[model samples]
Target chain A: MLKIENLQARIEEKEILRGINLDIKPGEVHAIMGPNGSGKSTLASVLAGREDYEVTGGSVDFLGKDLLELSPEDRAKEGLFLAFQYPVEIPGVSTTNFMKTALNEKRKYHGLDPLDAAQFLKLMKEKMKLVQIDQALLSRSLNEGFSGGEKKRNEIFQMAMLEPKLAILDETDSGLDIDALRIVANGVNQLRSKDNSFLVVTHYQRLLEYIVPDYVHVLYKGRIVKSGTKDLALELEERGYDFIKEEVDQAIA
Target chain B: MDVKSNLKTAYSQQEGNSTHLASFQTENWKTFSGMGIPALKHEEWKYIPVKNIFKDEMNIAIESSNLEDTIIKKSILPGTEEANTIVFFNGRFQADHSIIHEKDALVVKSLETAAGDEDALFVEEHLGHSQAYHPDGVNALNGAFASGGAFIKLKKGKSLLQPLIIYHFSDSSNGFRFSQPRILASIEANAQITIVETYINIGGGESFTNEVIEICTGRDSITRYIKLQNEGKHSNHTGTTHVRQLERSNTHAVTITLDGAIVRNNLNMVMEDEHAESHMYGLYLLNGNTIADNHTIVDNRMPHCESNELYKGIMDDQSTGVFNGKIFVRKDSQKTNAYQSNKNILIGDQASANTKPQLEIFADDVKCSHGCTIGKLDEDALFYLRARGISEKNAKALLLQAFASDILGQIEHEAIKNYIEQLISERLSFQA
Candidate 1:
């Protein structure tokens, strides 16, 4: 459902993602694990069409469409969802209102009628149970003064609302306790279907234990150095990433 | 004739017509002639070109024959039908057109008649009190024509359910129109009142409204004042809303400027007694070549006085916005608290904002803080909204609406607040 070839991206003069290539089919989950500053987040940002990072050389394909040519909003409308590492706090904009606008916008893009108030409220109530989010939290300003766990759960709630074909989870496990991690994972696992895919980016294997991935890829210095089954994540967690770094360095020498 | 000669002729014609305010008018006319129109070099009028607005030949003559009842009816704000309506046509108060529903609790009379009647002492003590702080030719020009103004008083210990709505209509169809509308209101002890001021201009010709509304709050009284200026691009306005809070009184003022050619507003809160409190809020949402300048002053004269002020601006296209907030803590005003903040967002490349905060704190025991910021919209917030599938245009509109919500929420009057909210929503093309 998604493919990236020779993706070379940089922010300003510093190169971040150098020669990244990945492919994922429907119903498959791929995990990208790397050490700090190994271009894992950069890869997610590039796919989400963040304008700050210039893609010097890249071609991304999503369901046979050139994804790199679309704007960030268009990409979102085209069923690409990026769960931010840190959700922005926007004052005076209620989460419910934000979600309503976003949902209607995507519906319009798909040539569908917007859901009525009753329909929207019903869908929201159903989705609220999946993420275990409170209605009062959604009524307040979006992410303004929200706790870390609440913010992540809100992100997952939005992901569920949009029901994108492909969702990218960027460091969603960071700053989350064991309980929050379990809740977030449960929500994601419930949304998983044979027609949808996920690219889970993380720094540890803790998140993988709850929502086990089909493949594990270790990124080192802007390139994936190793790929294996879900067991590789447990192996890396026990042994650390130094061994992988050493192998890549030896290969370079 | 030119505007200067025309004003001079008008002044001469009305020199001795009324003995009530003749000496006051003479003194103000002298001040206006001496200062002539304020030049750009004048510190108070540096950004606004008040002289240029008068370059065109203006008809300062008072004429109300062209104004029809239908026009007044159409111009009345929705949801304010039960309000006590006070009408002004070409700067002259139209007693025949006004309607006062709460006659027992409220008193509305012409300034000239009030100055000569039993309310003479009250009118004399409060009229032109804003001149002490402003001390400018523009303010004095309005004072020179104060005879055509209105006097409003809320009886002691009375609270009116319906607010008083003052509509200033300027008819500029014949030529460039210049109008001055002045009002002085007294809220007696333990009384409560809400005053709303809005402007309406007839015809496509350019119109200038120089207004002054002075309010005196008595002991334990509460006063709510709202100024809504949404006149067309051909209209210009300069107005002063001076409020004095006596002995534990409370005051709240909100000013909303939606559209104008060049608008300048002066809002002052003078705490004359201990434990007096006041809140000042303003929002100027502008597009096109509009210019909205707001100047606010908070003076803590007595001990234990408190004041809070917040003014926000959203400038789009070639619009310009300016804000100057001043807070003063007198030597004897110990335990005084004052806070001021001005924030602006520039949406267009050519849009600009100028903000300044002046604080003169003398009392060592007072708490005073002031801050100002001018910049573009938050890029992170914008991207966060756009990434949610909202169009860039809609995202901007949503963000701007949120930016303006802080000031809009300060309006306590439901109907007036909703009316202004609708106007702002349409201005920003924002829904929901």
Candidate 2:
């Protein structure tokens, strides 16, 4: 479903993702556990086609197409979703309107009919409940004055509404309370299907306990230095990143 | 070009004759000619040069028989068809096009006609009265010419179901035309009325319009005014509006300046009675070389009065925008609450905005606050939209439109609100 070859990226002349490669197939969930500055968010931003990040070298392919060459909107139309760690607050625009426009745009790109008002409202009600989002909150401006937990849940609600084939949860648990974390993870787990895949990026293993991953990789300094199954996340949780750093350094020596 | 030069000389010569000019027309002409047009050196006119606009020779406003008749056929506010409608051509009121209804409840007539009457005394009282609040040359120039203004009076305990729509059309085929439209609206105690005024330039030639409006609201009266200015690129407009709450009234006014070459608007609200309330909202969308300047003042002179104001501007290209909002809580006005805010967006690298939200509070028990913000589009918001399958252009347009919707939502008329939405969208290239 996704492929990256020699992915070299930088921001403001500072090299972040230096020659890293990763691949994911359908029905597979990949967990990327990285320290504070291991280019975890950079990888998600590059995949999402954020213009500020310069892809200095290499290419990214998604669904057998040149992902790096596509614009951000086109990449989204091709079924790429990024659950931002910090959701933007767009005042005066209601969440319903924003989500409807986005969902229709993606649908139009896929050669589908735009949802009418009634149909759109029905879908919104269903998905909003699944994410435990308040209906009154959705009626207000988009993410305006929203709490951190509410913004994360809203993001998950949108991911459910759009149903993108490839979803990247970029540190979705960073600011969420335990309850919000459960709700967000439950929403993701409910939407899980064999045809869709997720790239979960986080620093803690608490979120992984709820939304289990198929594979866990430790990203150290822009490159993945260790790969294992779900147990690796638990081990890292019990031992912390220092154990992994020592192992990586000894291996390099 | 020679026409402009000749017009300048003609205007200067007329200034000399204006002093002796009989108050037979309006004593205002003398006041306007006495002060003349202001220059950039003046503190109030520092950003705008009113002198250079008239430096070239232009055509004196002439009555046009070929004026477009279909213009008055359109109503700016819904339900105005059954109400009184006043039409102005090149700054002169057209009686033949004027319509009136509700004879016993309302009195609608031209300023010249009302000036000749004493019983309809509001004409003499509030006509050009904004000068007391705004002493600038622009207000003086508008008051100096006393012709073609509209007069409206509402009887006590009367409520107008339909609004009064005023259309001020500027046509400059003869050359550069200058128009002065003075309007006086006086509502008696327990009366209610809504007025929607809009301007559109028809001809290709340059036109300069200076207009003043003075409103008086009696005890427990309610007045709502909506001003829309969408003049063409070659037009220049300077408008002043003065509103006074005589004895505890409620007033709401919104001004939307969508497009123009050079547009200036001055709005002043004086709360003279206790427990009065006022709200003012302004929005301007400018591109190209257009410049829009808005200056507003709210004075709380009585105890327990409140006023809130918000002005937003969206500028692009080489266009420039300015907003100066001032609020005053006089020493006698105890328990006054006033709030003012101005926000602007600069879409182009060359586009700029200058905003000053000022508050002067002398009452110890009053609460006053003012703030201003100027910024480019929020990148995080833009990317959030782009990542949702909206193209970059569309994303920016959405955010820009949202930035404007706060003020547009204040429009009480749904059709007018939709029209502004379409206009803003067209300017953003979001849709054809």
Q: Native-vs-model 2 lDDT? A: 0.83
Candidate 2 per-residue C-alpha lDDT over A82-119 given as tens digits, one digit per residue, 9 for 90 to 100: 99988999997788878888888888877889999999
Candidate 2, residue A185: CA error in Å? 2.2
Per-residue lDDT tens digits for candidate 2, residues B16-66, read 222212252345545655676777888777677667667355565345545
lDDT of 1 by residue, A90-128 (tens): 999999989999999999899999988999999999999
Clashing pairs in 1: none
Q: DockQ for the candidate 1 complex?
A: 0.69
Error of 1 at A79 (Å): 0.9
Off by over 4 Å in 1: B15-18
| Cα error, candidate 2, residue B301 (Å) | 2.8
Highest-scoring model, lDDT: 1
The TM-score leader among the candidates is 1
- Chain A vs native chain A, TM-score per candidate: 0.99, 0.97
Query: What C-alpha lDDT, on a 0 to 100 scale, does residue B134 get in candidate 2?
Result: 71
